[model samples]
Target: MEQKQPDVVDIFAVEERPGAVVFALAVCLGALVLLAQMDEQTKWLKGAALLVQPRFWPGLCLAGFAFFALCHFISTWTRHRKSRQYSFLPPDELANWARPTEYALYFMAYVFLVPQLGYLPTTLLALPALVFRLGYRSPSKLMASMLVGLCTVVVFKTLLQVRIPGGRWYEFLPDGLRNLLILYF
Candidate 1:
């Protein structure tokens, strides 16, 4: 006797998902709204209290988009069920959930390190580890990651003159090495 196949819900597919994607989108929009509101809520009492005036326009735009998307998705969710726009993603059971979990852990580590180690070092370190975790054993991957980091430093630090944190970790290095790092970073 043959076993019956389990029914799979492809959340991206119109006929299959039963409107769950709409709910998910709504939730995402809700999150954006909350974040944007928080950004506006924390404006400096003395006007741009940080070293520079951080941009607030992007947050404003996100808030506006979230409001409209919430309205549109809620209203049209049912109507769109008849649509043929199927999502390409496989069912949750077939999806590799472990990857996201691993990445989330990496993200948490990145957050903890950013303040102590800063952006340049954090990014340079994260790239090689991420590439290794993703199972790319080739030396080229490591080289490429380093090259990308170098390009990022040149473009953002040298060309654009963007202010990236030098991080405290670099200070622990010997004088010559630290000076070399500071020159590039």
Candidate 2:
């Protein structure tokens, strides 16, 4: 009896993820470059109180992301080279996929709606939609998930006093709504 070797296809399948990795690296690099330029514009302020200088933390974070992304890109490239297979997608998968597109659209919608709809409504809607899409079938589970999400938002926004994205819809709601929300939660 002979042991079967792992298929070349299986090893190279990992390479397909490099495209996503490269895209992330490019985005991080772009953010770092932007932060560096902004830092240069505020060079005069650096001479002020060292603790008060606004750019220090953000610039450091951006630099850190860039460094990490660079390492990831290099490691992924080496893996791709060793695997010796260049495939953009899985062998049987279609190029024009709608699932990813749908998720992106949902994310954008959530961002845009957050400021107007308030935290609770937007999250309540998005949570159930995501849960259902992820193949969760039980109504009880969906309700429980939504409740947890709503509570998290309430804790962050109300108890923690964290700034939540407020939208036009929030503005139209009566003062009673705010009072009601605060009292109920």
Candidate 3:
């Protein structure tokens, strides 16, 4: 009787991500170039002490990460070129990612809206919508989400003095409560 050989699967970089790796590398290079070209005499940089300039740490860290990503990209490209593997997940797989991609867009929109609507109002609006989207349709759950939003507002804004993006929305609160919010937040 002959012994059977096990099958092996190999993943190649170019086959794996197609254009995504190149796009990421280009974005990284562009960001590094932008950072390099930034004026050093900006007000924030001018005001900061040496070694503590506003851009120093972030620039250094981002440059380091970008360098590492560049190295990885080159290594992957070379390895993939030499590889015999042909099958890989394709960019067309994005069609299968509609729900998650939409959720990510929703999250980004939420971030943008927070400052405009203010924290409490944003949270109060977003939490219920998120819960509903996540398939929790109970009235009690929505109400609980609303209650949690109020509690979060009270704890962060009233008690802990966190300056959660305030807008003209706070003006609608009754005077005593509004005064407290003005004092703490």
- Specify the highest-TM-score model's number: 3
RMSD to the true structure for each prediction, in A, is 11.0, 7.9, 7.9
Given candidate 1, what's the lDDT at residue 113?
Answer: 84
Candidate 3 lDDT over 1-185, as tens digits, reads: 98755545433223545544555566678766766665553335556686787767776776787787678767756655667243233445445545488789888987888767767778889989998988999999999999997898788887887766565566888999776645544
Ten contiguous residues minimizing lDDT sum, candidate 2? 88-97
The superposed Cα distance between candidate 1 and the true structure at residue 140, in angstroms, equals 1.8
Instruction: Score candidate 2 by lDDT.
Output: 0.69
Better of 2 and 3 by TM-score: 3
Positional deviation of residue 21's Cα in model 2 after best superposition, in angstroms? 11
Candidate 3 yields a Cα-based lDDT of: 0.69
Per-residue C-alpha lDDT of model 2 across residues 68-145, encoded as one tens digit per residue: 877776776677666755543433333444448888988899888777666777788888988898899999989988
Q: Is candidate 1 or candidate 3 better by lDDT?
A: 3
Task: List the lowest-lDDT window of 10 residues for candidate 1.
Answer: 88-97
Clashing pairs in 1: 12-87, 13-87
Residue pairs with colliding backbones in model 2 are: 115-166, 115-167, 116-167, 116-168
Error of 3 at 154 (Å): 2.8
What order do candidates take by TM-score, descending? 3, 2, 1
State each model's CA lDDT, in order: 0.67, 0.69, 0.69
